[model samples]
Target chain A: MQRIVVLAGGIGGARFLRGLKSAVPDADITVIGNTGDDIHLFGLKVCPDLDTVMYTLGGGIHEEQGWGRSDESFAVKEELAAYGVGPEWFGLGDRDFATHIVRTQMIAAGFPLSAVTEALCRRWQPGVRLLPMSDDRVETHVLIDDPDGEGRKAVHFQEYWVRLRAAAAAHAIVPVGAEQAKPAPGVLEALAEADVILFPPSNPVVSVGTILAVPGIREAVADAGVPVVGLSPIVGDAPVRGMADKVLAAVGVESTAAAVARHYGSGLLDGWLVDTVDAGRVGEVEAAGIRCRAVPLMMTDTEATARMAAEALRLAEEVRG
Target chain B: MQRIVVLAGGIGGARFLRGLKSAVPDADITVIGNTGDDIHLFGLKVCPDLDTVMYTLGGGIHEEQGWGRSDESFAVKEELAAYGVGPEWFGLGDRDFATHIVRTQMIAAGFPLSAVTEALCRRWQPGVRLLPMSDDRVETHVLIDDPDGEGRKAVHFQEYWVRLRAAAAAHAIVPVGAEQAKPAPGVLEALAEADVILFPPSNPVVSVGTILAVPGIREAVADAGVPVVGLSPIVGDAPVRGMADKVLAAVGVESTAAAVARHYGSGLLDGWLVDTVDAGRVGEVEAAGIRCRAVPLMMTDTEATARMAAEALRLAEEVRG
Candidate 1:
């Protein structure tokens, strides 16, 4: 069985994992999900990225929305607002709230995030060993010109993304606790034993970038000596979904697909897949000392996404040679 | 305005408060809700009795159920169960969950239960000033004959009442932290400044009984020298609502209006109101050195409940004279 490890973030990563699972049904997949976006809201621990992956693979995700539970109700959110408690911007539904509550309860009981994720997955049965990047808290903070026109201030990633809609120009994207955080129990081991590692078409700066920021994760992928492949979230000169361009700019990367590949760089990433539209820039990515391929990267549906996953794997095989 | 202080529990107490609010719109009503029955579930602090009062008075309560929110969804509870985390019997709906989350968040932020209750009530505007009996944690535990047939085991009061449905014979109902708990900030002051204090037709054992169990609360009401009138929860030979009889038996009190009045005694209780069906027991209760009145005590509707509240006030005046 092929051992495939994927480092992922929320929505885009979740959808990619669902497709990858379809492309390689029998592969032993282990996912190291970004916990840099993990937040405590209403005293409940909400791991948006981990939940997105679980729900997407477990058949509970809201397909249209790309995150949260399908057929969800906002009763809990409304009630919290009614109590005059808010950061009312983040849309956590009732079904989604339960996940956070259970997680929070387990964490309070002294269980680590990775353990809690595993326990939650027992119900979702997301078909892979899902691990948080680290059991330690690591929140992504985006430094932006304060909306009120003061000096720059660092806002939580969710605040910048969900609340502000990434309207403000981001100056920097910092994974707040990543420097001191160790990889969760199975993270480094998964990297060591993996046949190939894939970085899903997630936000390069905040999602995949934050996961790489964890103390030893990027080093593990680099030293593992296995083909490390990545799918571009940016297509042509823009993100297919989400505000990836805004955060990419924070890290001084252009919105172009070739820029993201170069941002991960030749040292860490062995192979990079861009879109058919960005085929012209494939040479530029290849010149950066990373093998490159341009393919249809739009994840319009499962079949389309699965084909993209297969293309990524094919590129990984080419890099191996 | 007549400054009225009420000692209360859950549904029964909440309904009575609604009636009291209607009966004396100008009265400065202060409710010292029982907190011994508070249970922490899923890492959220759930104050069932306090929520009952808030929702009922705030017009958010399920009219038929009398406890949870109206139009509530069980999505959160169902999701929790799907994750295999539950007592399964306590039916907390999504809207109700928000209340717990907000309270838990505030508590975690170092707010006392009383202050949290006050903040929550600001949203509910429950017409009355609602205060928790004590700011400190106080969980009620019921010792019951072990279902495994070995020996008596103690269960959280909610497990005994909600999960077990009170089937097991209760040996004792212990307020675990009541001995060490002081009245919440406004509790003693509410009792001291009151012109009259009322015990609504709530469970004598777990409701009114638990409030009086808090050390200084009973003394404050007694020393206030104000008329302390109580409406019996027992209608004929049984409790008007809840399994008050089972818990009363645990405490060695007979399940009768006269018996409950005598249980409070003439010192703590200056007057007691039994239902019209138990009119004959009034003389027996008065002979026990307490002023007693026979009135319609069934809270079938707000109007009927308001009449009962008015009758309790009339009895309080009679005792004062």
Candidate 2:
């Protein structure tokens, strides 16, 4: 069986995992989900990225929304608002609140995030070993011109993305605790033992970028000596979904498929897949010393997404030779 | 303004407060709600009795259930169960979870329960100034014959009342932290300034008894130089609502209106109101050096409950004379 390790973010990563699972049902997949977006809302620990992946693969995700539980109710959010407690910008529904509540309780009882994620997956049976990028708190903070005026202020990434709608120009995207964060129990081991590693079509700056920001994760994947393939979240100078361009600019990278592969660089990434529209840039990426292929990267549906996953695997095989 | 102070429990107290508010809309009512019944579930502080009062007076309480919000969804609870994390017996709904979440957040932020209650009441506008009996954690634990057999084991009052359905013989009802707990802010002040103090038809053993267990509270009311009147929860020889009889048995009190009034005694209680069905016990109670009256005590509706509150006030007047 193929040993696969995938570093993931929220919606985009979750949808990609769903397709990856379809593409290789027998593959031993281990996912290291971004924890930079993990937040404490109403005293409950909410791991948005981990939950998105779990819900998506477990068949509980809101298909159209690509996150949260299907057929969810916002009674909990409404009640919180009624109590005059807010940050009501992020949408956490009742079903989703339960996951956070359970997680918070476990963390309070001294269980690590990875262990809690494993326990939660027993219910979802998300078909792969799901681990948080770190057991330690590693929130992503975006530096932007203070919305209330004056100099730049660092806002939580979720607040910037969900609340501000990424309207403000991001000065920097910092994974606040990543420097001190150790890879959650299985993360390094998964990479070390893996036959292949893949980066899904997730936000390079905040999603996959945040995971790589963890001190040792990027180094481990680099030394693992396995074919490391990545699918471009950017297509034809734009993100397929989400405001990848805004954050890419923060990191001084242009919003192009070629620029993203180069951002990961040839030292870490062995192969890179760009969209058919960005086929013209394939040479540009390959010239940067990473093997490159042009594929239909739009995850329009599960089948299309699975095909993209297959293409990424094929590129990994080509780079292996 | 009457400047009435009331000692209260959960559902029964909340319902009575609704009536009390209706009876004297302009009265400076201060409710010192029982906190011994407070339980921490899912890492969230759940003040069942306090919430009951808030939701009841705020017009959000489930009319039929007399606790939680009307039209409340149990999606959070269901999801928690799916994760196999629960006591499962407590029926906390989605809307109710929000109250706990806000409260837990505030408490974790170092706010005392009293301050949190005050903040919550601002949203609830419970008409009356609602105060917790104590700021400190004072969970009620019931000592019961171990369900798994052998010697007596102590369980949280909720586990006994909700999970076990109060089936196991309760040996003792202990207000775990009352020995060291001070009256929450405004509790003693309310009692000191009151023209009259009332004990609504709440559980004599677990509810009213728990408030009295708080060291200075009972003394404050007794030394307040005001008429302190109480309504009997027992209609005939049974409680109007709740399993008050079971808990009363734990405290070695007979499940009778006369016994309950006698339990309060003439020292702390200057007057008592028994239901019309227990009218014969009125003379028996009066002979014990406390003013007693027979009145319709059934809180069948808000109007009926208001009448009961009015009757209790009337008895306070009679006692003062």
Candidate 3:
């Protein structure tokens, strides 16, 4: 009867789900996907975080890239390149495009993203309930001085990340419309009923942080009356993957394990897990009234990821006791 | 100053354009695309024929299939299958989905399909003006008995053809709203100013026929004052490719070279090409007041297709002389 809820970001979140599934195959796992990374390209809504989880769990994911499906092709993308559409930096393959189209179509047809995600998950049969952080639109836009245009303008996250390759420093990172977004159906219920909550080694700022930004979500998790444990996305002083260091700077957060644990703080986190490399910072994190543990968090393989998931679960139990 | 206006369908149309480019290297080619096959699936508007031309001329087309770009994948489609959302007959690739997304988005943003096609073409750089017959909606719906429900109902052309695999006999074919569809921008002008007009081996009923259905387009071609030459899609008593027989029956035209020639009529066609197999029918086509020519119309390769283009040009010149 253990109900576990996890908040997640893209690649990291998807990878963590893989581990969590392995660790608790029969547990009622509910994942709250970050929608801040969602982007519209070529008229299709692409929720990278959601798809990653779907592919990873469905066993269609590219084992190495940990993102798109295996054996991907670029014909459609090349054709699109010929069409000169979108922020081409993010490699949207032909096969991946279909998912976006279906999701986009469903969203346009008035289905909330959570329901759309569920419908998508049915085919993937990901063996867990997946919920979007919010049903309302909340895009991550970066305010930067336009190098080509007059003054500063908000550019799509993909444009800032993929197209520009995240070369330009982001002045301000805003999850557009987050203040107005409502928790998706089943999201709050999943958190309130959960015996434990785990933040997989997903981006603490953009992934789980974005979930907290949803009006009622953070409050619901804090009041869930259970252990809320987060594994640090940072190891020593760097992120596990992607340009998290660059994004962390945009929000005035240091790319350190201690800083991430402190960012979640006693407000929501009951326990925090840091990598062995950051064992020295355990006292600092624990001083914030959060129980802390040191463990290996790199998801090098399924076994390693599952080990990390097991450690998080063990910590959650200790915090509750 | 050879302004060649081509009325085209899908793969056949795109293959012919490759040859037409070689025959008249400097000819200003304007392709008026058929929108009858345009479909809305999962809310995204997909224009298959338009993509064929763009891909073929841009050198991104699948060399074997003659449609979609070469080296394509179905990851997105597979993912969509996992989600269980679609009519599921037409195979959509991930990379290809991006093009439709951009086009659909732009169209939603008030850009006409014609303009959207142009925007898409800029990326493909297909070296020709590609125009949809109309920007206003015109979907070719086939009347068939409801597969799940009782009685007769109109199903989308894609559903009838791809999903059902054209299993049921079509009771009626209607290009919905074509009567109200205005010729897309530049379609009529290209026809009126053409030095020569070519009808590639596209489906006469669903492909070229739909383009002509746009108001003022068919009349403009008939009165263009240029020699209008059409290569027969019907090589013998069958379509060179595709289910032209099924489509021909829907439009009440027999699947024969002579019948197709007469379907276009002498008022429109100056020269009609018949394959060597239909050489015996050439005299009958000529009696319809069209100067008919017998030639090897099989587009087996670029060289063979180019020769076919040269013969059509020579026939057009002979008729004028």
Candidate 4:
């Protein structure tokens, strides 16, 4: 059985994993989810990226919204607002709050993040071993224009993405605490033992980049003798979904398949998948010393996403040869 | 304006307060809510007594249930159970969760319980000043027969009341931190400056009893030189509501209006109100040096309750004379 490891973000990463599971049902998959975007709201631990993966795989993700739980009500959120307690921009449904409350309680009782995730997964049975990027706090703060003054200031990634809607120009993306943080248990082991490591079509800067920012994780992935493949979140000179272009520009990368692939570099990336429309940029990505392919990357449906996953696996086989 | 101080519990105390407020619309009421029954559930501070008073007075209390917010949904509680996390016995609705979340967050940010209660009341605008009996952690633990073995064990007050439904014979009722806790900032002042202090038809052993257990509160009320009056929770040789009879028995007091009045004693209680059904026992209470009255103590409706409150106030005036 192939041991597959994937670095995931929130919505896009979770959706890609569902397709990956459909593509290779027998594969032993381990997900090292980025926790840089984790935020404490109302004194409850909320791991948006982690929960998205769990809910998406567990069949609880809201089908239309792409995040949160299905048939969700905003009773908790509404009441919190009534009490004037909030970051009302980030909607946490009643069912979703249960996850945070449980997680927070376990954490308060002294359980580590990795152990708590495993306990939560017992109920979710997401089929994949979900592990946080690091047990340590690694908040992704973006340097954005200060509204109160002319100077630049740093805001949490969610605040910039959700509250401000990424409207402010981002100057830099910093994964604070990553420098001193150690990768969560099983992260390094999974990477070294993986037959293939895939980077799903997630935010290249804040998602995949934040995971790589963790001290030992980047080194472990690079030194692993497995093929490393990536699916581009960018297509047709723009982000396929969300404001990836805004944060991509912050890290001095253009919103294009070739640029994102080159940003990962040949040393880290063995193969790259770009959307079929970006076929013209295949030569440039290949010329940068990384194997590249143009495929139907749009995850319009589960079947389409599965085919994309199959293509990523085929590219990994080619890279291995 | 009459300066009234009341030590409140949950449903019974909250209902009595509604009548008191109605009876003396211009009175400045300072509620010293019992915090001993407060419990930490799912890592959030749950002050059942304080919230009951707040919700009941602020028009949020569920009228039929007599606690929590009206129009409440148990989505969060249901979800938490689905996640296999809880003491499912305690029913916390989504709307009520907002209050605990706000309170836990504020407490985490270093605000004392009193300050957090004040902040929460700001949103409810509960009309009267609600002060916790103590800012300190004083949990009420009841010694009960352990279901696992023949020996006895201690469980949280909520567990004894809600989970066990007070079915297990209680051996003792201990206010765990009362011996070390100081009265909250305003509690002593409220007692000292009060023209009258009223113990409503709340549980004598755990409600009004817990507030007085706090180190300075009982002493302050005794030294205040003001009229101290009480209405019996017992009626017709049983409790008016709840399992107050069980906890009353734990303290070796018979479940009768006269026994409850004698339990308060003449030094602490100047006047006592027994139900009309217990009119025969008023003479026994009067023999114990407590000025007793047989009024309609059943808080069947707001108007009836107001009349009961009026009777208690009238008795307070007579005691002063």
* Residue lDDT tens for model 1, B1-321: 899999999999999999999999999999999888899888889999988998999989999988898998899999999999996888899988988888888889999988888898888889999999999888899999997789899999999999888999999999999999888998898888999999998888888888888889989988999999999999889987789999999999999999999999988999999989999998899899999888888898889989999999998898889
C-alpha displacement of A252 in model 1, angstroms? 1.4
Which model scores highest in TM-score? 4
- Give the TM-score of each candidate: 0.98, 0.98, 0.84, 0.99
Q: Residue B165 in model 2: shift from native, Å? A: 2.3
Candidate 3 lDDT over residue span A1-321, tens digit each = 689999988888888888888888889999999999898766678898889988888887888887887877776676566656645688877567667777777788888888889887877888889898988889889887786777887888878877876677687888899999999999999998999998888877667888889999989999999999999888879987877788788888899988888888799999999999999999999998999999998899888999999999999999989
lDDT of 4 by residue, B1-321 (tens): 899999889999899999999999999999999888898999999999999999999999999999888999999999999988888989999999989999999999999999999999998888899999999999999999997788999999999998989999999999998999989998999999999999999999899999999987888888889999999999999898999899988999999999998998998999999989999998999999999999998888999999999999999999999
**Candidate 4 local distance difference test against the native:** 0.94
- For candidate 3, the per-residue lDDT at A276 reads 95
Number of the top lDDT candidate: 4
Interface RMSD of each: 0.6, 0.7, 2.6, 0.7
User: Model 3: per-residue lDDT, tens digit, B1-321?
Assistant: 788899988899999999989888888999998888988766878899999999899987889877775666676676567567655668776566767767877889998898889888877889999998898999999998788888888988888877887777787888999999999988888888888899988888889888888889889999988899999999889999988888788778999999999999998899999999999999999999999999999999988999999999999899888
Estimate the TM-score for candidate 3: 0.84
In model 1, state the lDDT of residue A278. Answer: 94
Candidate 2: where is the Cα deviation over 4 Å?
A: none
Error of 3 at A284 (Å): 3.8
Q: Write the per-residue lDDT of candidate 4 for residues A121-233, one digit (tens) a residue.
A: 99999999999999999999999998668999999999999999999999999999999999999999999999999999999999999999999888888999999999999
